[model samples]
Target: TKMRSNGRIQLHSEDPHQLVFEALLNRGTPGVIAVDDFVLKDGRCDNETYGTCDFESDTCGWQLHNWERVTSQRISLPATDRSTRSPSGYFALAKAPGGRMVSPLKWYHAAKHRCLRFWFFISGTSSERLNVTSVVDEDQEKSLWYGAASEASIQQWFSASVNLPAQEKTPMVVFDAATSGNPGSAVAVDDISLGNTPCPPPGSCSFDEDTCNWYNAGDLTNAQWYRHRGATVSNLTGVQLDHTLGSKEGYYLLLDAEDTSARSLGSMQSEALTLGPAVCFRLYYVMRQNSGASLSVGFLDEHHYLDGRATTVKATTPSQWTLLQVERTELPPMFTIIITGRTEQGSSDIAIDDIDVRSGRCTTAETDPEASMPPTTEADSPATSHVTEPMPSKQPAPPEVVTWQSKTTAAPATTEPLPPVVCKRGEFKCRTENTCIPGSLLCDGVYDCLDGLDEKCESGAQCKENEFFCVTRTPSACQPRSMLCDGQEDCVGGSDEALCGACPAYFC
Candidate 1:
């Protein structure tokens, strides 16, 4: 089959066993065209019911155009299927000269929220790509996710979660694969599930499989968080088992001091989160005796600036994992949790696992009074402890109060002189926090201010001619028009990459 320049498909056959070849073009109505002995069915999986497919025995009601259900033993592309992790397990596979496999149409309401989670494996060349799209009315389609094999390893199976757009009509989910004619290229998908929830809840991580979106701040020159399962390479101080599973099989984020010089600091930041009234952050950590490492947690505004004093742990305990909880009543609306690990002389390792963020204040028994102590004014603190200088202010000064609790003595609050803040022109000053960000970053779908004041623009606000407004996101956002169809989801609803032209136009 060949795709013509006029956007029509031409089918040809020369085999003697093939007697006839017929072509029919429906000019008016749009529909699926079946050839040979193939047939198309509704294969409905309703919206109210949970939809899932392991692909163990069959396609599980999905309509295959060029995709096929095969076992890993039969195809050497993916070494093992994610569902069963065995060679005999079945999975959907697509090869070169690619086509699409689509799910049955399901009724979706405009108000309902759902997420599609799946594990996909891609191996071979960079020319192979997979796209997940939502199609409605047989023509209109929105890209949910698209990527090439270059972003992942050949044998590793990566998990993905995409939020399905809410549409009033019946929409079919499509998995379209396009590949170069290289025989080495292939794509595999398995363990697909659709649930009525968000893809990932904010600030929750176990590090059992992936980093859960937590990323290194890249501030330290030689130190960063490493995901490890068993003991450290040095086998000198790190935890032998993870806190989550209490075994060597489970993974945790470890900061090994053996790889870096003494006093090196490393930090990891979580994804952005919106905090409610009272919030509690909890995690499990291990700090061995003579480790000479201090662990601290702090808040970073959306612009990646540290907001307030961090909760630091100075003393080391036994090799066992310890639970720590920090509860705060006053916090920025949009902030990210930053965990910093600093190594002093003789430091060995510091590991953390099972970080969680939730609503409501922590119980009295769980809250530690020492956790609320102000950060030390030591010069060797992590870079995240230093807040950006604030812009110059002419407003009236208010009395600042500082208070602390001690078992031996009670101290009264004392007023101190406020430091002058200065910011360059075209920078927006955060009202509650002493930080400044570029004015252009305001109303850009990201919360650049600690108090979220930068995102307070009215809906459908006007943008420059070279900008595209993201109407689907709350408060809307303006982004550069060049981001459209860039194979990256810049807008909240993926509007930036949706409705792109077919790939065959360029690759063919």
Candidate 2:
């Protein structure tokens, strides 16, 4: 069952209405389980509630931006250079006090549901002080939250409208950045983008044209970082490899096809390349046995056809060059990534290049934070996207450097140990979705919390005083689950669960 190309190509920005689908895996690939780059290095994840890794800032080396679109003029937008962070401070627009804020790929330690946005840049006199938080899964003190900032160089875009509740006492949404009047000024932040609102080319979802060509199931090509995409021989000098790294050090576009018409879907010349929001794909050909061959890789925006055509996976391994990855959401804005070698009953040879195009992560759930958001609601939220609207109140940025004394790393978690709590009620305020046990109620059965863990039980089923039944069988209902953990599974597994219940007492 190994014939997947995920067929994708979607990442559009000048905002046509936003669409999404071309993917790259903040993590995913052939065998991709490669962990242990291990940098929390001296003791962490021992799991206190996941808040360690003093690697602090400088973010591993940065570079991890699959996508983002919060608005506030990231200066000149189009960015993708990437960074989990670089710091200094000064920003505003309030409202962000919980559900996702740790840092560095995989979202440091917390992020559930996803979709929170922000960005701030400043020019100085803004002495420093910024601390915004979002810790959902690594739950210490219940999903924390914070927010605050004075001003300088100023540019802003803060939003939070959905997806929190992965657990950790749940309520860690904090922000408190401070600044004086002009001391150093150079605070940049391209952060806090929670998800959903990604279309109009927001990742190139679909285009549909197929006779003149316009097939974007999501594949616009341009992953170009380490460089890799259907290469028969990147630079093996002349072609050497037999041992893994010599001869041809790294070259593999090998798939010996003989039937299935030698499946071929490489070049359709739909304008010579420029159609990937997802069309369709197929690689790895094999039909070289009784002259009966197979080779495939076909996509159709238009060159003649009538029904969803894309074949090349009929009898399996023709000798293997197979590595087909597609994402398919129906993109046809001029499509063609063909390579078809067909054989109804005779000669076949299916051997194609190494065409790689994978990138997808765009959806978390949100619907508020001031104008310009229509990346995906199916449609209807883009009254405007060049971004313009703030005269009613909370959207008047571009001023701050009101100094007092400071340094920078966004200069204001102060090193953090936790416990400051002011979190917006709305003085033009913001921040408040770490909701562990405030006013947002509905956990029934009793014990609002002297320490019943929040009610509802099952596994060991105890009813000490509030009707404890740790055995709702497991569907106990918590709303937004998955702090990881579901091997054989159970609800909201937070430390991946092992403190007592849902099977981790030492397996099966």
Candidate 3:
């Protein structure tokens, strides 16, 4: 008997002869092959039926090599499954000494593409990495995504979305976790699903995937904005987690005042954006009490010049994230958003996240009416300043202002003549006082000058042969050449420790 393309069995006989066939029946079949009575439509498998997995009760048909179903109590890390967000929830976990976990092969077809969405938790050193890949063929695999947890993300779960392009053949999805053999390190994933829908559109940014076209204005000030995850390096200053994810695993734009001089300003400029008749800009910010930090949002023209007045806000609630919305009308065709942060030698840091821009006036439900900007004629308070221009025939609400105290005061007049001091080639003159100090004392991480002038090294400033100049940092910085590659970041920009040779595995 031969099988035909139509799946029918036909008997072929070259010599025609009388043939008698007897059917044999037995109470128990010795060997039998069973086939599922289902046909795949268009040779495509439903992702909801084949690709979705929660790992709550079991591995959900996924083959696990080194991974196992685990609960929060079983893991040393303080993380809950994304599915339930509860300690009792279960998730697939791969501990240090890891390998690959794979899903069953399936053929997927969609109008556009399939999106794989999952929540992952990684708690380990930099050497530990978790990668998601799809095996297209016997020897071909395409990487979907890969990431490693930082020191602050050990307790937080992060979400990931990957687009799976249409393939000619069925593919097996694989989760490969690698480690540096640290017994405490681990990688966890839960609540995975594949669907035909594309990933949601990201607005301006949540600061979770880089600054999103926003860049630090290098010439603004010595204080620089850093893209950071988890709590800042300083103590009792910045937020412990980002607002978007409410987890340390998320990213935010931070302006740390701890490492910068007093009254330092840090500015971030957005890419040029088109504006409609009316626009609303929104963002989330945190400024701790006594942070001495003030935030301002304003517009800039295409030429990078300020187009209008900036709306500044001060810290009100300590260590709490506040929502800020600014509504503008009669805006230029194209403009950029300028976010500036200023610190007055305070201990707290300023952070902002989840910036969004949209057309039309900010709705009342989305803004705090009580916190709206007051009229320009409102007298300035000691701890806050409310400034706005007179409205035209069409009232355009000014940006909401949360302001801080201005500690600056006019200097008293002095009649006495001061003596002038001249410094030698190897000496440095103080900017605020008539004093000179040796050039070697500059940027020593200490304030040797009365006004800290010796510590403020300008960009392109000449340094001694034995000094290492940190050219990347604003206002620059200098350190002893011997301190280069010492593993410690003495420069604000970490230029001192950059380009250092990699450390040995054991030492890392």
Per-residue CA lDDT of model 3 for 199-243, tens digit only, reads 322225665644544666532224668778787767455578777
Question: How close to the true structure is residue 489 of candidate 3, measured as C-alpha lDDT?
Answer: 41
Q: Global lDDT of each model?
A: 0.58, 0.27, 0.57
TM-score-sorted candidate list, best first: 1, 3, 2
Stretches of candidate 2 exceeding 4 Å from the true structure:
1-123, 134-175, 180-188, 191-224, 227-508
Question: Candidate 1's residue-wise lDDT over 1-508, tens digit each?
Answer: 1101111112333554433446664444222334444332344333244366777756666888888889878866777787667798888988567889898554334355565667787765556778888787666887766656554422445555566655577578898887775655678889777755443344666776556556665322436687888887665565788867778999888877564422256677765555544667777777766456777776754334345446677545666566655666666655667787776535567778878766566654433322222223344233323211111111122112100100111121254234324333234567788765554455567876778977775532577768865533211246677966776544433445534664422235
Error of 3 at 147 (Å): 33
Superior candidate under lDDT, 2 versus 3? 3
TM-score winner: 1
- Least accurate 10 contiguous residues by lDDT in model 2: 218-227
Best lDDT goes to which candidate? 1
Model 3: residues >4 Å from true position, as ranges?
1-203, 261-263, 366-508
Q: In model 2, what lDDT does residue 92 have? A: 28
Error of 2 at 250 (Å): 13
Candidate 1 or 3, higher TM-score?
A: 1
